[model samples]
Target chain A: MHNAHNAKSILHKISRAFLILIAFTATFTAMILSPMLSVNVNAYTEKKVYDYGDLLTDREESRIEEQLRKASENCGHDIIVYTVKSLGGNSVSEYSQRAADGINTDSDGSGILYLVSINDREYDIYAFGEMYERIMSDRELNRLADDLRSYLSEGDYYGAFSEFGKRVEKAALNNEDYSGNISVRLTLSFSTLIVSAFIALIIVFCMKQGMKTTRPEITAGNYVKNGSFKVTVSRDVYLYTSVSRVRIQSNNNGHRSGGGHHSGGRSSGGHHSGGHRSGGHSRGRF
Target chain B: MTTSFKCACCGADLRYSPGSGSLKCEYCGTEFEAEAVEAMAEAAESDAAGENINWQHANPQTMENDGSTCTYSCSSCGAQITGDRTLAASFCPYCGNTVVMSDRLEGMLRPDYIIPFKVEKDAAVAKFKEFCKGKPLLPSGFLSSGRIDSVEGLYVPYWLFDAGVKGRVRFRAERVHTRREGDYNVTRTQHFMLYREGVMDFEHVPVDGTSKLGAEVTEAVEPFDMHGAAPFAKAYLSGFLADRYDVPQETCRPRADERIRQSITSALANTCRGYTGVRPQQQFISVANGKIAYALLPMWLMTVNYNGKSYTFAMNGQTGKFVGELPISWAKFWGFFAGITAALTVILTLLMNYFG
Candidate 1:
């Protein structure tokens, strides 16, 4: 009877050890698989390319998406490219705004979106947040659109999107914007210091010259007798006439209002009912 | 020969008093009218002539001139004073007594008119201080280091010219008209050939007559009011240094003509108005009825030494107009420049950030 009882106790201890091994294996497998699952989710969510129009192949879309992702990382702003088959009942501007509003990534909403509508043959660029206030203006958006219009007209959609990515990246890196409305990073560069020093030297030189009060008198104005000047024969004869004409320059460049439809009803941080986002856009037929 | 004026009361040396028109004794404080002093000297000369006494023997200070230089004995201290032929009056360095070289002022060298000093030495020193007051860049030690004893009264000779100028001036002038026509700016310029002829007279244009003084230095203190001028007398030379005309009259004629030409040309140019631009094409000026006279003008001169350099200052004795070049302090200049530059840089940066 004692031998039988010891055999039962050993058997119970073996089963408990087997169950613990099973639980450890299951928890370790879950820990490894969960990260892969989250990575897949983040990869989809972080995608900057939304090609619903079937303009690019899967491979081309992936390549452009990777390019835009790197560029966004570099410029600290999300850059997006969205293509749609139809705008439904909305204008290109509203469609683009909806596309921007649908972005659910974890980035701060300081970004720009390039939208293309295949059926409507229209394209638009929308900016929000810091990117809007710093570098995006109506003129700059139009300039970017004009630069990519040729590729779009040629039906090289892949090339157009790729060039768009490159140009946006370059512009973001340079922080270039429309003239007369852009903030400049103030720096006391060597050239600025040199020019300032030169100007200062000239001012001080003039001040030093003022110390010299003596100069040779070349005119005798003080010695001229008053009331003694006379002009006996004064004649003004017409000799010839010459005429010149110059065309006046038009000063209307870069002051044009955007041709795109604008809605002051989207917040920079999130979509709202009627609050206007501080941003700008440009739209045109491709 | 040097002649030192003596006080009639105490026999002490008499010096010419500014704005008083008289000689005042340094010891007795007695003043004698300049005209009365001249009358007494003339009466003495006549009495010596009546007695048939040699004037040089009676006045032992008189001596013969040796070519371009003259030596005279000071009546007050008996020190021998030597100077160039142009030196009409000077002070004896050892005795600090004034001596007038009477022989140098004889004959053709005599000045026709003299403007007596109206600004005294003390007033001139005050004017110097005033002149240096407003200058910010002047060296800090310049005014403090300047000595008052270096200031001296001087009678500078000048050649006064009166001339009637007849001139003809031709100018190429233009009248420009600008009009806007349909996105174009149309400019029409009317060219004209202008001729102006004039006759004018200039009175009493004084030119510096001493070669020792530069034209710039002498011309700076100008227009000694001829109204204050009196007939030149030897009494005016007492206690003051005088310079005879070292620059010849012929040598100064070109300067007078140049000045007259400039005046006439400017006068003719003034008549041409209502033109956008006028440039002189040709000018022909002829000076007529030119008259020249010699005069002695008063100037207060001082030399200040600073930083091992001497700077000369001069004041118009009649008008008290002082002129001099002041030294610049580099420390102050650089500090001001840096401050202005920093201020402007900050302002420009703020403006760019706000507007750009």
Candidate 2:
């Protein structure tokens, strides 16, 4: 009986040891292999939606994420929509940049980020890498922000995100670089130059006229005798009336629709960890 | 015959002091009333005529000529002088003495009235400098004393006219009104035919009587105070040069008539107020009881030379009005043009980028 009890205790001890060892080995294996698997997942499928603020439902987030992925595929650039509960002592710009660094995993490091910070009540639009080069000017970025401002203001996050994806896809597909429209730029430049030339001509002409002081006298009003003018006959006869109408012109272009306190700044291109992010960002309360 | 005024206190030659109504001697500083001097000269002339002396022939210093140009001997220096027949008074080039060619001022060549110089030479020079002060394009050397070739006071001849002008003027006038309805603009206009007739009198309308002076420059210094004019007196011409009417009265009548026609048209147009696009259609005018009087008005004439070109300036001696054309610097003009164009272009470009 004594031998049997001792053996049973030994068996219990080895079993406990073996269980602890199994737990530790499993944890160690997970620690080592989880990162490798995660890297594989990140390489293959990048998450385009991060909804920490709970502003969007699971279905809506999924829908938007899929839409963004499709748009990214269409445009050959990564696109993301990230929402946060708070900025955690960092500016919306800094937080968005860090998030973009983690999210955009493409080899080319080309992506666009639409970030929302609920606690700060602010939003940011940042474009980097190849996207930055494609959207060349701040004016085009402002135009994009203007399009989304109304939707965001109305608390329509899904619509705003959806519309943003659609617009990015459409803009990329059209491939009409706003800054690269050389004809329009040249026309505007020539017009400004002509107006400036006209103004200069008028100034010089007036100065030239100032140099000429001689003028021929064409009236005898000075020599007219006072109280000597008389009127013998006066007559007036009316003839006819004419009327004309013209239509006033209206601008129908859908631009500059929403009102917001938008502020913009130059982003350091190729200076951040996201890899050659040479673009601008506009931030404002929606 | 030539006449020269002499001071009574000393036998020195005298000159009419501007704004003083008197002749002053530069040597003795003696002042004599212009009227009293004229009276004394007339008495001497009558006495000499009563003695059967032909002053034109007896005066050995006098020379007569019937051609376009006349030669006279200066009383001060006995220098022979030749000039245009219309040169009534001039300074002798040899001695700088004021000489009046008496033959030029006799009969129809004499002026009926004279407006003496109220502004002196120093005052006129100061005015010209002030006039040159604010002009930016004037050449830097144009105001220098060396560039001022001459400044001379001359009594320019003018013909003054008095007439009654009778005229009728017709005009096509329109009243326009515009209003906006919805998105369209409607403009309505009412047209009418208007007629006006009037008889007006004009007095002392002057026309330049010398072809030597441009009508444009002379008329620019016009509206001389006719009330200040005095009866023609040779004494007034002692210090300044003078000219007789080389342009006859008949030749100047058309100018006076044209001026009257413009005045009548303006007067009629002024009556048709509260209307736009008032255009004169037809006009008929007649001048009746037209009378002409010759007068000598005072002016200070200056000539400036810059870059081998001469520019003339004139000042109304009675009113101190000055006028002249200035030179332009093309370098400064183009520089200003470039600077303004660059600045405006940059500004417009920035605006378009922000708002386009």
Best by DockQ: 2
User: Best candidate per TM-score, number?
Assistant: 1
In candidate 2, what are the lDDT values of residues B1-356, reduced to their tens digit? 33454444455765443345556567866555655455334333433443111101100112233455544445864544344556553554223344555443222246777899999888887877777777665645456545332466777878888777787777778899999989989898776667787888887888988775677678888878888889876567656655556677777877877787899999998888878998876666766566778788898876554444546678898998887767775545655566566666667766876788
Give per-residue lDDT, candidate 1, residue A243: 81
TM-score of 2: 0.53
| Clash pairs detected, candidate 1 | none
Report backbone clashes per prediction.
0, 0
**How much does each candidate deviate at the interface, measured as C-alpha RMSD after superposition?**
27.3, 29.4
**Separate DockQ for every predicted complex:** 0.23, 0.25
lDDT per residue, candidate 1, B1-356, as tens digits?
22344454465765443345556567866555655455334333333433111111000123233355554444764544344545554544223345555443232245777898888889988877777776766765567653645566777878887777787776778899999999999999877667787988777778887765667667877756777889876666555665566677778877877777777778788888999788875666666566777888898876554554556678888998777767776656765566555544545544543565
CAPRI grade, predicted model 1: incorrect
Q: Assess each prediction's global lDDT (C-alpha) against the native.
A: 0.67, 0.68
